[model samples]
Target chain A: MSFRGAVVTFPGSNCDRDMAVALEAVSGVPAIRVWHGDAELPADLDFIALPGGFSYGDYLRSGAMAARSPVMQSVIEAARRGVPVLGVCNGFQVLTEAGLLPGALMRNASQHFICRNVKLKVENSQSLFTAGYSAGQILSIPVAHHDGNYFADDATLDRLEGEGRVAFRYAETVNGSARDIAGVLNEAGNVLGMMPHPERAIEDALGSSDGRALFESAIRSLVEA
Target chain B: MKVRIHVSLKPGVLDPQGRAIHHALEGLGFEGVNDVRAGREIELDVDDSVSDEALDAMCKQLLANMVIENYRIERVAA
Candidate 1:
């Protein structure tokens, strides 16, 4: 069976198409386009991606309005059912606001929107999102966001670390995130939320192929399972 | 009833916007301003029939993100 994927596009989502193309190129299957207003998702989806962009104009707080939108209900439900969910940049903020992931993405400590390729350490390669990378491997991914500072209580941080749920960490801190946490996994290890834009780095023409590993790893896990 | 919700970042949480504002204030020659922590105030004009529990739920669930912020509700007499 061919891999099936979906990319959710919020009103101000700018990178939805990039996410779609990346998934299609890597998984060899067309990704369904899901709108934020839709009440449901396509059936039997193997993966769901929340692309980067300023959803709802970053009003009130980044991802706050989009997280409460109609489509996120189904996305959250689908993620709970063991379907792989990858949230990038603003999508990471949405998942946290929707309670699918922990912590919050506050404004960058520099108080500026940072856009650049940064090195990340593969903290955990056991999850479906990072299996293509080995533990301790370094990869460069593009990060562009104003509200990407990760914040959580120290106890929760300790728990996330102790449980091996930290999927990636910035090799050099860029956004003043607590403990340099670049990405994380949900309790079930099926949902992944990260600030970096891996979709933008999938092709060498885009300057890096490190991101292809993420999509490839996920597809491999889906096919093998 | 008119409901006012105050949403403020939790203590010890970094507030970059607040810091920026503070810096701007200092640049303007303001002195002795120890710190500035910014917060949001939301005003909701709801019916008197809305129960306190429901209002509290609204603050806890949506109006405020409890991860790094705290919310307090103030109700005006109907």
Candidate 2:
């Protein structure tokens, strides 16, 4: 069976094409490009992607406006229905804003718009989006954002740690994220949000293909299930 | 009804923007600045029928992210 996915494009989204291309490369099928204004998602989608980039001009806050937009409501519902969702960078912000994920992405402690490739440790390879990697494996990925500092209450952080919901953690401190967390999964493990752009690093020509494993993992989970 | 919402990062969350501003102020020879924190203020002219619960809901749902920020609403006129 062919894999089905959709990459939502918001008004300021710039990485939607990259995400779509990466999804197609992994699934061997063209992924649907969705619009933020659309209230309904393409039905029966195995995967949904919230790609990186400034949405709503980063107004009020990054990903804040787009999180409340019409399309995200449907995306949130689909996630609740067991469809896997991936949110990178601004998409991560949207998920948190939509209450689909815990914690928040605050301004970087350095107060700079950081843009660079960083190493992330595969903390939990059991989730749908990360099963392709081994536990504690360090993978180089790209991160670019002004507000990637992850903030959560100590109790929530402890809970996430105890439940093994922390999907990826930074090998070194790239931002002031709590416990160096880079990616996280919901309690159900169906939604994954990360500060790094896996789509940006999926192509070997682009420098790092470690990110390819995430897309492949999602596809594999859908196909085998 | 006129209302103002003030949003600020929860205590213990580092505010680098505020720190930088504090440094800049010190560079200009201003003293006695014990601390600095950054926040935003949003003013709204809502209908008279809008209740306190509705205003609080808006803050919790959209105006503020409770995880890292807090919001206070003050109604000037109704």
Candidate 3:
């Protein structure tokens, strides 16, 4: 069966096309485009992606408004049902705001919008998202955002680490995230949220093909299941 | 009713914007300032029919992020 990936687009979502293209390039199936205002998601979706962008113009807070949008209700339900969901950058922020994940993305420590490629180490290669990479493998991916500082209480941080839920960590100090976490998986291991734009790094021509493996990993998991 | 919601970063949570404001204050030679933390104030003009519980729920659900910030709701005479 062809991969049924859906890319959700909010009013200010800028990377929806990139996410769709990445999914299509790897899965050989066009990703269904979902609007933020819609109350329902495409049925039987194999994957759902919340691409990076300043949804609702980052009003009130980044991803805060978008998280409460009509469609996120369905997305949240879909995620809870064990459907694979990947939220990148602002999408990551939304996932946190929606309570699908723990922690919050705050302003960068430098108080500047950082845009560049940073090195990330695969912390857990067992989840559906990171299975394509080996543990401790360092991959360079691009990140661009003003609020990517990940913050969680000490107890919560410990729990996330203890549970092998920290999927990726920054190899270098790119943001002021606690323990330099770049990506994380929910307790169920099906939902993944990350700050780096893996969708932008699907090919070597774009500086690195490291992100292709992320999409490949999701596809491979479905095929094996 | 005039309701105001004050949202401030919880203590111990780093506030980069507040720090930046502090640096600017120091650069301007403002003295005796121990520290600076930033917060937001949102005023809502709601009908008297809106209950306190509804206002608190609004603060919790949308006006303030409960993770890194705390919000206090104040009702003032219009």
Candidate 4:
């Protein structure tokens, strides 16, 4: 079966094309482009991606406006139905605002916009997005954001850790994310949100091919399942 | 009616902007400044018929992120 993936684009979303290119490169199928104003998603989507960018010009809050967009309503419903969803950087903020995931992304502790390749250790390799990586493996992915600091209460943090929902952790202190959490999975493990841009690292020419495994993992599982 | 929605980070949440402001204030030779936390005040004009329940709902649903922020709604009489 052919892989079916869709990339959602909100106004001010600059990385939507990159995300689409990465998905097509790996899945051998062009990803459908969905607009934030649309209330319905394309049918039979096996995977959905929310790419990084300052949605709504970071007004009110990063990803706050985009999270409430019409398309997100369908995206949230799709995620609840077990369709694999991947949120990268600003997309991660949207997930939290939309209540599809836990925690919030705040201003970086350094108070500066970060744009560089950082190391991330794969913490959970059993999920649909990380199945290609081995547990404890470190991958270099590019991150670019000002408000990528992840925050959650202690009990919620402990619960997420206990439930094996921490999918990736920063190998180094790149951001002030609580407990160095770089990525997380929803309770069901079908939804993954991360600060780094995996789509930007899908090729060696892009400085690293480490991110290819993420897309391949989703495609591999959908093909077999 | 005029409504002011004050949105603030929940206690214990790190406030980097507030910290930056504190540093700037210290640079200006100010003393006895213990701490600084930043918040937003949004003003809205709505009909008097808009009930308190709806105002609270608006704050909870969109004006505030329950995970890390708290919002208080205040109505100012015209």
Better of 1 and 3 by TM-score: 3
Docking class of 3: high
Instruction: List native contact recovery per candidate, as a fraction of 1.
Output: 0.87, 0.87, 1.00, 0.87
Minimum summed lDDT over a 10-residue window in model 4 chain A is located at A1-10
**Per-residue CA lDDT of candidate 4, range A98-205, in tens?**
999999999999999999999999999999999999999999999999999999999999999999999999999887999999999999999999999999999899
Best of the candidates, DockQ: 3
> What are the clashing pairs of model 3?
none
Candidate 4 stretches with Cα past 4 Å from truth are none
Give the Å error, residue A55, model 3. 0.4
Candidate 2 — which residues are off by over 4 angstroms? none
lDDT of 2 by residue, A1-225 (tens): 778899999999988999999999989999999999998999889999998999999898888999999999899999999999999999999999989999999889888888999999999999989999999999999999999999898999999999999999999988889899999999999999999999988888999999999999899989999
- Show model 1 residue runs off by greater than 4 Å: none
Task: List the per-model TM-score of the A chain.
Answer: 0.99, 0.99, 0.99, 0.99
- Per-model TM-score on C-alpha atoms: 0.97, 0.98, 0.99, 0.99
Which tens-of-lDDT digit does each residue in B1-78 have in candidate 4?
999999999999999999999999999999999999999999999999999999999999899998999999999998
State how far residue A172 of model 3 sits from its true place (Å). 0.6
lDDT of 1 by residue, A95-178 (tens): 999999999999999998999999999999999989899999999999999999999999999999999999999999799999
All candidates' lDDT scores?
0.94, 0.93, 0.96, 0.95
Model 3 segments beyond 4 Å from truth? Answer: none
**DockQ scores for all predicted structures:** 0.88, 0.87, 0.96, 0.92
Best-to-worst order by DockQ is 3, 4, 1, 2
- Please tell me which model should have the higher lDDT, number 2 or number 4: 4
